[model samples]
Target: MHTRRPFRTLALALGTAGLLISGCSSGSSSSGAASPAQAASVSPSPVPAALKSYYAQHLSWRDCGVSGFQCTTMKAPLDYAKPDGGEIKLAVSRKKATGPGKRIGSLLVNPGGPGGSAIGYLQGYAAIGYPAQVRARYDMVAIDPRGVARSEPVECLTGPQMDVYTQVDQTPDDDAEVTKLSGAFKKFATGCEKRSGEVLPHVSTEETARDMDMLRALLGDEHLNYVGASYGTFLGATYAELFPGRTGRLVLDGAMDPSLSSIELNRDQTAGFETAFQSFAQDCVRKSDCPLGTTSADEAATRLKKLFTELDAKPIPTGESRDLGESLATTGVIAAMYDESAWPQLREALTAADAGDGSGLLALADSYYEREPSGEYANLMYANAAVNCLDLPPAFATPQDVTKALPSFEKASPVFGEGFAWAALNCAYWPVPATGTAHRIEAEGAAPIVVVGTTRDPATPYHWAESLADQLSSGTLLTYEGDGHTAYGRGSDCIDTAINTYLLEGTPPPADKKCS
Candidate 1:
């Protein structure tokens, strides 16, 4: 596929430290026939050659039992093409089946990020939040994917380097600022190659999907039963594409569209953020503490946009040298879009920003960037970039591509499109070239796959969930008309009950199931 160079773009996404970061990245694809499915009753396939040597070198298992749980490590080839080239160890943990009757097998979990550590999710959330019956009948498992935490990580920049990078003016105007921004991008990319060249090139979602297959075999399961969130949905969809028959009771919440090119993905996401912003705006107008307009949602948006423009020209000073500029302000706003829970906090931040006290907004931005009070960064951004760069090729090749794409992006998301479109360019200058393309994933004959979407989800839009559901031959759309990134575990009892029933009983939710 033809790639275009991207121009400057703004950014935002929370990583492992449980905060958001504003930036962009790039990715690759895989070519291999999935193993044919056998009867639901059968012995596990032999470990793939790629996993055997990997298992020997990197894994060291120990006793880990949290009530009815057993933890272990699973190893696989870093590069599927050359499985033996080297191995990357995945941190695997599982809460074994506590059955009332016949038990199925292990059900793996991934909490998105493309970089969000599944093990972290398993320990922090899923191990407790998942429905009791589902937890009772099946082994709830988690694996940190290659280049993600607990695996061979991909380190890009240090805490201090990231501090500078995050503070860099994202919205470039004059040539000098653009040069500075581009230099930051170059430094971040080069740092990835320099610090993690060995595995950076192999961290694509497709590779991670393949790794899932190997784990399925090693766990002695006949098929893979898994639940994925946010970017995890993309990973699950990719797995379904590659190993259709092996899929079992899969739940892809906060679904991502595999067909959209980088430009389309960024544009759609930009619009999604605007939709979320509109929701927040409408809510804010009704609330007294709203920093923006107290009238219509559009008025609130207009007020916010004007602030963004003003900040672009003259950044407000925080107590620290780093102030709330257009980039950081945008980052704070986008971070709020991820979860409605953050809306009030964002309003406070905006109030602070409006009053020329940018500390609140900076804190929000810092949370998004996952920068702790101590200034250390979790590996989330590094792994996010590594996986993104490997999943698909660059979105832009030159500044002209971004320019050409700007109008369409703006139309898609009047608030966030241009910045996101320009942000897509960050991959253009990646040290490792992208090897993947936007492709359709039609998991024909796969067991019914439950796809969950939140109506006002920020990171992964609801429509993408609808599109992915339509694309997968057996995908069943389960809608949660609510706010948040992923719906299953975010306090939606109905959503959780529906998914839990499916996971435990193997009965898919109704095709058009809607839970408010």
Candidate 2:
């Protein structure tokens, strides 16, 4: 039930224009060698004989149901280590560039769900809402990663089962509650193994990055040009590492540091969400209708925590089958922390929750889970756990480990720490062994890669962006001293111009260049 922070906010926040101002700049920062633009050879590494067909396959792009967009499918090895063992089809989509400017190449984008549909992202916003100049010169492309939406999505529990899973108390107050939470995790793991055991081991970020290279070749591009946000940044970074020579114009927004272990990531993210909430608290106290309090940020946070305490005692009715409990209310708050524009909504939701109407908070939690009106949930949470559990070892191996980590997590964020710490236990019961380990991604020979960070980002915190930029040999750091998840296209003309210039001109912004 921990959202490892979906990068979907890139589209969710940017999708609404009137809600953003987009200013990002930071004070002192550090970066690695900022190399000038390195030409991307159309000729990437020679295709291995095993992958020749996958590389040479033609995409039969046709009108997707969505206007101005085309969709196609491409084949990839289900188990990349064992190519030809079997094939899984990946869904791809594109919007061809308009005129008035020469086409640069295909600009691939991922909104980061590990489960977020890149194809959906392209159609929903990237294809049409991106800067016109950039769109004019590039074919906006997206490939739903192997187990994500549009592709053969990894299935787990049914709608009713997921409902039970989401409502399971994350912050266990006693042994019985703890046992219940642990049982839920085991059941989820068993369900996923029963249904998607085959694909679970194959959905690692490393595999998805390889899939991108395949899509790159099929698109007839010499090098890959991409914009990845949140978890997408990790995917892009992995690609750059795996195929440094073929990386071109990569913009890793809201970058993630691959060096952190699962424990480190979860703890840091705990602190990050707290940081974002603090920012929200400060802003909230300035408004007259602030539910927590207008007295002060500290008081507001205290009040919210007190509300969570009350909800733990008795859940509030949402006018639906589901009620607003501590777990869902926490999720609702975390969802709003992704974008500042949602702060007002969070305040209103909290106000309503305080008044015994939990509908608003439930709605927010539903959106976070990608729950449909039909009561079915998107594969988002399922695939999120799939990719995360496979990409790194479980954050905690047992309930005892969670108990040991609670104090440290609480120190990170007193409000969310306990629940977040317990949430990390969700993956401990995974059926598959993790295939990836936490390590630095140097991508030494890649072209100048742009790494963006938001100072108060709730997920994929600013420090992760700084760490990534420092790790990559040719990374250029672009700091956004602002709130929200990803920076580009969110309204910072500075952020947009810098990234667009990099994508269009192959010239990254100067290292440590803060956005304004």
Candidate 3:
């Protein structure tokens, strides 16, 4: 279980993780070392005999305050190696099938924040918005991973503390600014250690993957049928690697390669965001109201870069205690890169920011942070760092390392690269050492899994999907020749039809299948 982890103070931008290329590219990442012993294998160690009770545990479900949904709590060992030492409870939710057709069991959904609340995703969007045919045939299910919302969430900074963290200058110009940013990182890590002391080490993606398996067995499913997006893809793939024989109908949209080192992950994601911005810029320039200007994409990029520089010099007002600084502004832009649907709002936000009213961009930044009107934030960022820091070693152990990587990062995206390089340093100050390493995951004997990729996906690059498909022995590549993060359920009938067919009928699309 591995993926990208950006600056928490900036809402985990630049997509997630460094990934394995073809043939489990033998590469070492900031994630410790690429040891074969740590690498995921087709033959995973069997369930420990001591953990029989966990496998046999029962779920007591009842109305969870939400209409048409049932909620339950699940118990699993906090540390797998010490099953009896302690246990953690995971939050689970499900909406039973509408049932106009034959039931096809539970369809687990995870919208990949790594720290994202799968339960929230299920209730908020997936339960109501999925295709009627699919919803009617399957019970929509989700389990908020440990240390995520509704679970034993990981807490770091308070709302006010986080507010200050968010405005930290990502593109530092002077030694003082760099030291200030480093101090902020240290504060955040120290806070999490003080606040979420117990669960930090156990929140790795691998742990969440095991949690998913526990859910699968508790639900009485012989095989896991899951739709995982972004970092969720890494979780799903890890499950397949750990329990290949029990995996079924896995759809990994916006997939993450399990083999990425921290440096590769951050660099690749920076480039990925650049690709997404290029698409947005091209589209924005076609309209007269383009915020960056109705000019060539290159010129638009130059203008956006200039704006970032200007914001770094002096943040504009957002009519709030916190101003729209470069960090927040960049986060706002990166948030829109995840979905084309948000592009219009991004354009409008940029238009407003350019005119000295930073409110719109600030609002966009708030959305990225999942900030509520009351100023409280969701646990997404805290868990993101908790899991990511545990999943891979820091990309750079010192600020000097980041300075060394700056040239390469800048080459990736001149507009966003410098900030991203600095942002990558966030994990360096993690309270605990990384428990995981950059390794390959090949679910050798698993059922054919559908891997979906959006060509211009800003966060999880299309190449990642390609590499993931190639990594899994029984993988099928389903390409959506379009933009955005994930392809399915994004208005592409061709992509959705293929996924729906696989979920409903268990027949994956043909090799080299392409959708627009």
When superposed on Cα atoms, how far off is each prediction in RMSD? 6.8, 7.1, 8.8
Q: Which stretches of candidate 3 lie over 4 Å from their true place?
A: 1-46
lDDT measured at residue 112 in model 2 versus the true structure, 0 to 100: 86
**lDDT score for residue 58 of model 3:** 73
Q: Largest TM-score belongs to which candidate?
A: 2
Off by over 4 Å in 2: 10-44
Candidate 1, residues 447-483, lDDT tens digits: the string is 7899999898777889999999999888899999987
Stretches > 4 Å off in candidate 1:
1-60, 63-70, 98-102
C-alpha local distance difference test of each model: 0.74, 0.84, 0.82
Of models 2 and 3, which has the larger lDDT?
2
Q: Is candidate 1 or candidate 3 better by TM-score?
A: 3
Error of 1 at 284 (Å): 0.5
Worst 10 residues of 3 by lDDT: 29-38
All candidates: TM-score: 0.88, 0.94, 0.92
Instruction: Rank the models by lDDT, top first.
Output: 2, 3, 1
Please tell me which predicted candidate would have the highest lDDT against the true structure.
2
